[model samples]
Target chain A: MMDRRRGLGRYGLSLLRFWSVSLAAQMEYQLNLIIEVVASIATLAGGLFTLSLFYAHGQRLGGWSWEEALVVLGLSTFLDGFSSTLLRPNLGELVKQVQNGSLDFVLLKPIDSQFWVSLRNWSPWGMPEMALGFGLVLVGLVRSGARPGPGGVLAALLLWACGVAILYSLWFILAATSIWFVKVWNATEVLRSLVGVGRYPISAYPPALRLLFTAVVPIAFLTNVPAEALLGRTTPFWCAASAGLALVALICSRLLWRMALRHYTSASS
Target chain B: MNHQRSPAPEPTTRPLQRIPMRRSPLRIARTLLVSQYALMVEFRAEIVLWALSGVMPLLMYAVWSGAPAGAAAGVNPQQFARYFLAALVARQFTVVWVIYAFEEDNLLGRLSPLLLQPLPLAWRYWAAHLAEQATRLPLVAAMVLLFVAAVPAAAPPLDPMRLLLALLALHLGFCLNFLMQYAITMLCFWNERVSALERLQAIPQLFLSGLLAPLELFPEPLRAVALHTPFPAIIYLPAQLAAGGPIAIGPAFLNLFGWLALLLPLNLLLWRAGVRRYAALGA
Candidate 1:
């Protein structure tokens, strides 16, 4: 147990180092860094502005009030920010690496290749979005008057983690397919468009579309469930289901990644 | 005859410019269109996927039509549905992706070769986009059909004259949108990161261009701003016309044509300046 704990600590240190390296590299281009930060903030603000426009005309969209909708929007932006910052810069490039056989370097690393590929690049540019999104979520909760107790807050945190897991797993499956499909580069785009659906509360959609969001794509768990938790609307059953989904997704993605590695005949070969 | 017998001059990049001279502009465009069509057909599934990416209006439709307070905004379910469905189709024609193509070319130093051609670089983008739009028309029609079948009440009675006008407006809108994006993309010559610059324009375009809601539904102050801007001429005018909404046909056509005329010259000026800057940088 001691040895295992030491190893885990070492791994954590290396991951921290990786993130610092990315930050250092980004800071080298000060103009690009500034622009990225500004653009991210603008994007988040633009989203909120659109929501304000909608609410300017009506008190409630579907059944949710503007504050509740803001919560969903904030959560979605946060997850999307996380994806763009960490998940996208890394996994989005997996297809090109596979095509060029540069993935060999990743596979040869002593560290877990999946972890390396997924978390290697950390964009400080997305920091503004991350900060804004968290802020919006707080403001939304306050404005919406949902005073969740400790248990509810904890549950929301857990479900939010599960949502991140699901999103990461979905991206993993897409990246793994790059081993077989040469032109699946746009797969991430498909993921992006689907995620855009989560910008609103799931209840806002028609019955057919809502079913598709929750069951087929499960994007509702990514934003809606967490927002719902904050609003004291989440049932115990949803919390368990979300946790279960995340575990299953992560495991399946691990299996898929391993299988894909086996099929990666190096471009040099 | 004697010139042919003379020893050939030293091969230079100048020769490349003349090689493209052998093909007429029309012939070159035809070939480019053919290849682009083939590419679009090859990526039919991807094309459909891209078409589905137009989710903004769909989301707007859901909000404006489903909400109880939507009627207060002068948008009943039928009007909201009709407006968004038409906007979706119009957007299929008016959307431009030249920013991505230009950015990639400039970053990879591949733009220099494109500039070497005798014809303007915009022709290549125009051909590709036109071919993609032409090829995707059938799919768009099918989508409109699917939407109409699903919501019969939203399908307004066909007004032949209005639709013809709308199609004309949409075609001009396509040209206007393409030229505007091309002009914006020309900034890549000076800026290293144009995507951020693009978002500055894109955010406004999203809000003001009727992608979120019809211009009439916007707050009164914003509605006035949108009406004056060229952004709405591309989407709101054509969509409103298609939905058979109360739009003065004479002024709408004039607005579209006026924007097109203004953009064409502006694009040409930007292209010339951008190319000069690009060459100065040895790119």
Candidate 2:
């Protein structure tokens, strides 16, 4: 147990060092902060406008009220910001490293490869979007007048973490496939397009697409389920299922990374 | 006669000869198209992925068909399907990546060699885009056929005139989009990282371009404003025409022409100015 504690401490220190270096490198371009802020605000405004189009004539999308749907949109925006902050920068680098055969250097490091690959870089540009997303969620909750108790809030947070885990796993798995398909960069773009469907409630889609999003892509869990949890509308069964899915996805990503590493032939080869 | 004998001694100063190179516009365009098509065909896999990434319209169609807004807007699910399927095809052909491509070339110093060529540089990018669309043709057609077979309501009635007009609008929209993006791409000479600005531009395009939802569903004022922008001309006008929806063909075409007129000169002006600036920077 003591050894495990020391190992955790080591990893924690390494994460801090990695992020600080990345942050300093990124700070060289401070103008990106302003650009990111404006882009985030514009994106949110456009999203709100599009959402308002549905509710223009007192129309509800799949029986979801405007405020409830706002919660879903907020969650979607938060995940998109989360992706930009972590998944995009890190996984994008993973693709490049694989292409250039630099994964050899990463694997030879003392730390775990997955941990280093996943958390090597941090970009502050996504912070504005994340803050706006959380703000939107708060506004949605207040406007909807759904006061969740402490337990409810905890459950929502837990489920939201599960959503993030699932998202990270999905991204990592796709990035890992670069080991075999060297040009899988656009594969992530396809995923991003599909993830855009989460901007609306899953039920808003046709039944076939709803099934596809839920069963195939699990995008429904990423946004809708968390929003439902926050609204205190989700069942225990769904909560359990979400947790289970996150665990399975995380384990699958780890296993896939190991398998892919086995198949990795360096650029020299 | 003495010249022939002197050349035999040592052909020291050869007479210059005019090569008489015939570079008609038609020949240049054909050569560019053929070469670019050959290049694009080599990246068929990446192109397929790009085509798949354009499923936004189809997803929007699903949502609109199931949402109450279609009924409220007096558009049936069948009509929504047709419009979005048309949008998918229109977007496939009209997609522009000139900003990204140009930014890479400028940053990597690849533009210098291309600029030194006798042919105008813009024609190279233009021909590359056309060739990409040609390579994308079969995949997009297959997707359209599959969607139509699955949802027969998406298949519009056979109207050759409308088809021809839609085709014209599609190519025109492509030109307008390319010119607009290329104009912005000229900023690469001034800024190293201009693609981030492209993301900002995309937000307006996403909402206003009728990619997410049809313009008819937009509020009256919003729809009116959107019609004035070049965004709708890029997707909505052509898609609506192809879908046989209610749209003024003449006015839509005129809007496209007007934007084309405005952007064409703007792009040329930016190009000339940007090249001078680029050269001054010692690039």
Candidate 3:
């Protein structure tokens, strides 16, 4: 147990070091960072405005109160920021690497290829988006006046971790497909569009779609469960289901990555 | 002796004749159409992925349906679905990637050679737009038919004449959006971050163009303001027409053409200025 803990601690420190270097490099482009932050803020405001408009027209959406809906939006925005900043800059590179056969360098590294690829780059400019999302979550919590118990907070934390795992697995699956079909970048975009539905409450969709998002794609597990936990509406069963789904996704993506690596051919060939 | 030499020299060569067989704009357009069509076929998978990205409308449809019945003021679930379905099809035609394309071309110095060509740059952009839309038509049609067949209530009332008119409006909408985007993209010649401007513009386009919701659902003053702008001519008007909603076809077409006419001169002016600003660096 002590050895395992030390190993995990070393990995965490390395990731922290990678992020610091990446952040410093990104800070060199100060003007671009400022512009991106400003643009992201504007987009956030626009999204909030659209949400308010819906509330103005309808008192509730998908049985969700306005504050609850805001919570879901906040969670979605936070996850989106996390993915774009970390997973996107790195895993998104997998496509180009596969196309150019530069992925051989990644595979040759002593570190885990998936771990290295996922932590290779970071966009500090996206930090503002995460900040704004956290702000929204606070606003929603304050407005809703929902105070979660200790267990609820713990459950929310666990579910949030599961959301992250599921996202990483999904992204890995997308990147893995490029090994077979070199031109699958657009497929990733389609996946983004599909996952984007999580910005709204799952109940907002039709019955059939709700099932698909919940079970097939499991997008509802990403944001809804976290938000619901914060609202003290999460059931133990739902929490377990989310964790189970994340485990399944992780195993499936691991298998896919191994299979795909076998098909990879260096550009020299 | 000099006069005899000059006469012999004059007899040695025939005068050259110039042929006036320059390609008409029509012929150039045709050639561009065919070439772009072939290119689009090569990128058919990408085009399909692009079409599949139009899920926002479907999401809104779900939200509208889930909203309390008659929750969207006066718009019912069926009307909402019909409107969004129409918007989806219209969007496949009106979507423009000029900003990104221009940014890349300008940054990479590819626009220099294109400028040397006798044909105007707009023709190339137009051909690309036409090709993408043409390639996307079948997919859009399949999606629409599937939705309508599955959810019969989502089907919009259609008369042959009205459908024809709506198609015309949709085409004009595409032109209006393309012109506006082309004009916006000209900023890349002077600015490296035209994407910021595009995102800023998207705020208004989303709110005013009825992408988020129907314009009628907007509060009275906002609705009036949105109607006055050219944004509605892009997606909302065509959607309204497709849904067989109350719309003045004549006035709508006039609104669309007016926007197009205004944008044409602005586009030309910007293009000239942008070309002048293009340093022709690395050429």
Candidate 4:
């Protein structure tokens, strides 16, 4: 218990530092950064328009109504956009760092390498995502005419938080694998492509993809199940299940991260 | 004396540029292709990886097409396949690396070297991009041919004239895409991380550009909007030709040529502005 508490604190500090550097980078390019922001806004708007078009064909997809799917798609985009701006760019550097033996510099720091790698930077152009997600939720709530009482709201927030936690944990574990194998760029792609399938509601997937998203990658737990709860369609099983899945994902990723650390032969001797 | 007596009766007519030893265009094309093939050997893995961008949307196509007759979106089952598959093949054929090359040159500070060359910079840039395309085109064409041969029955009837038009249309489509992306990339002179700006546009271009789904499937005003937009012609028009549709070939070419006319000059203006900004910043 003592060891776990210390480890968690260090991880929190690393995440804070990462976001700081990323925000600073965005500030440096203040002018065209506006275009980046607007471009992202245009894209999210276009995505929402696509979903609306589909919904025009039918009142519901599978079982969820238009707004419900919108909530899922909206949150999923927010999460993916968050990762793309903040994480994806950094990740493209991973193979280069390993190949060029630059990981040695990062390894020498007195920090958990996975924590450091994952939170090493923040890119704030993705800020629009949080606004977009919140906006979509508002739209869905207005359309559904169902206000989640405080209890429902609290549960949804907690679930969403846990969902992000699961996403972070999963990426850290996968990224740590680079320490063992340098050619895992495709592996990273496979993981992202796998997660992408989660943009739509998990239920729209056939049973196999559903299993893959939830069990194999557990990304659907990252967005869909939580969005479901907020839309007032969630069950106790979902809350318990996602919370439990979050715990399991965190534990497995942490263990994998540690094992990877023991094997982290710095790119240089 | 022998040259004067027998061979001197016929002196050859002068050719353009009056160069007696210049390489023929066909032979130059072949040499460029050979060199490109050799260079690609080193970057083979990257080419394969770049190729995967065409595959991910196939999954979405599968799911949407699976919907029962009436329940499907605006695209019927066959039209969806035709649109996505055409987009796939067209993408494979028309990819160019000009933007990447431009950004790389900017980053490495090597633009001066190219400017010093006697050749027209734009012609050299265009030539290098084409050299690469020439090598890749054969492989792409061969792949299509093999697939066609596999299913002789399903193969679109060979129409030589229309096929030539489609090839021309595809080349023009690549020219437009390259110019648009090149202009975006040249903005790197102002901001080094212009890839982010390009990426922010990715989601829109991926879906709305008629790659992942047809513009027709989009609801109401959007369907109308996308049809009018220049984005669809880049990938969709050429792809429809591959799937054996009777495209308004002349008008489509006119549309693409218009985009090139608009975008290339605008890009040049942006390059001028971006470079001035870079100089002011002491780059």
TM-score to native of every candidate shown: 0.90, 0.95, 0.91, 0.79
* Highest-scoring model, TM-score: 2
Error of 3 at B98 (Å): 1.7
- lDDT for residue B262 in candidate 3, whole number 0-100: 96
lDDT (Cα, 0-100) at B150 in candidate 2:
91
| Candidate 3 residue-wise lDDT, B48-166, digit = tens | 88889886887788777677634647777778888888888777788888788778887787888898898788889889889888899899989999888977887888677888888
CA lDDT of every candidate: 0.82, 0.90, 0.82, 0.67
Per-residue accuracy of model 1 over B1-283 as CA lDDT, tens digit each: 1122334566865553233225465667778888878877888766776777775687678766776656776667888888889898888889898899888888888887888877788888888898889878898888888888988866855989888888888888888888888888888888866766777677677777877777776667877766767788888989999897766677667776787788888888888898888789993
lDDT of 4 at A266: 74
Lowest-scoring 10 consecutive residues by lDDT in candidate 4 chain A? A1-10
Count of clashing pairs, candidate 1: 0
Here the TM-score of candidate 4's chain B is 0.72
lDDT of model number 4:
0.67
| TM-score of the second chain in candidate 2 | 0.93
Which runs of model 1 end up more than 4 angstroms from their true locations?
Answer: A1-6, B1-25, B248-254
* lDDT digits (tens) for residues A1-269 of candidate 2: 13344578889988898999999999999989999999999999999999998898898898899999999989989988999999999999999999888999999987799999999999888889988989888889989899888988998998999999999999999999999988888999999998899999999988988899989999999999989989988889889999999999999999999999899888779
Q: What is the C-alpha RMSD, rounded to one decimal, of candidate 1?
A: 4.8
lDDT of 4 by residue, A1-269 (tens): 23344566767766776777778876877765677667767767776765665566565655677778777877777777667665666665666677778877888877766666666766666667767766877787678776788888889998998888787676666666777766556556666766666667776655666677777778778778878778777899889988888898889888886787687777665
